[model samples]
Target: MKIILILVLFNLQSGSEVITAEFDDARACDLAALRTFQGVTAEPDMRPLDPAEGASAIEGTVIAHDSDGAEIGMYSCNPSRSDRREG
Candidate 1:
């Protein structure tokens, strides 16, 4: 039982590898594909980008996973519509 518990802990600690691909001018449809790929059902978490803090003109979304692991979600960003200027 101790060995089994150790193996389980090791598996949870060693996260799976993730491959990323960037798409230029990506559409809303692209997000659907990502949802399918990750098997995520809950609505993604969205955060606004503030240019005053030296952040780019982009908004970020957190797509969560249904499984228990070190990584809870995938973070993606899209262009922000805020008119705030950036340095």
Candidate 2:
């Protein structure tokens, strides 16, 4: 199954932004998230979203910190199946 990483950035003042990337599997998606977190000094907090019928997803919140170690913004990454074509 293919996995797509959906990233949503939530900013209180401005708004929210979404970014997506496709991967071959969930492991690759999760690794990409981890690598992204490493770049911005973020704290990773992961939780599983409620599954819908036959679908399952894992969502994680990344808290970004400024250079002085202050909270800047937060974003979530959810990995799920990307192939939606019916068999």
Specify the highest-TM-score model's number.
Answer: 2
What is the Å distance of residue 69 in model 2 from its true position? 13
CA deviation > 4 Å runs, candidate 1: 1-14, 28-33, 36-59, 67-71, 78-87
Per-residue lDDT, model 1, residue 60, is 47
lDDT tens digits, residues 6-80, model 1?
000012456643434334444543464355445543443322223466556324434344444233444443433
In the predicted model 2, the residue pairs found to clash are: none
Which ten-residue region of model 1 has the weakest summed lDDT? 1-10
Q: After aligning candidate 2 to the native by TM-score, how far in Å is the CA of 75 from where it should be?
A: 8.0
TM-score for candidate 1, residues paired by index = 0.33
TM-score of each candidate?
0.33, 0.49
Query: For model 1, what is the alpha-carbon lDDT of residue 58?
Result: 24
Cα lDDT of model 2 by residue, 1-87, tens digit: 666766655456777666678787767877786566555555544433444699744455455555565544444444454456658
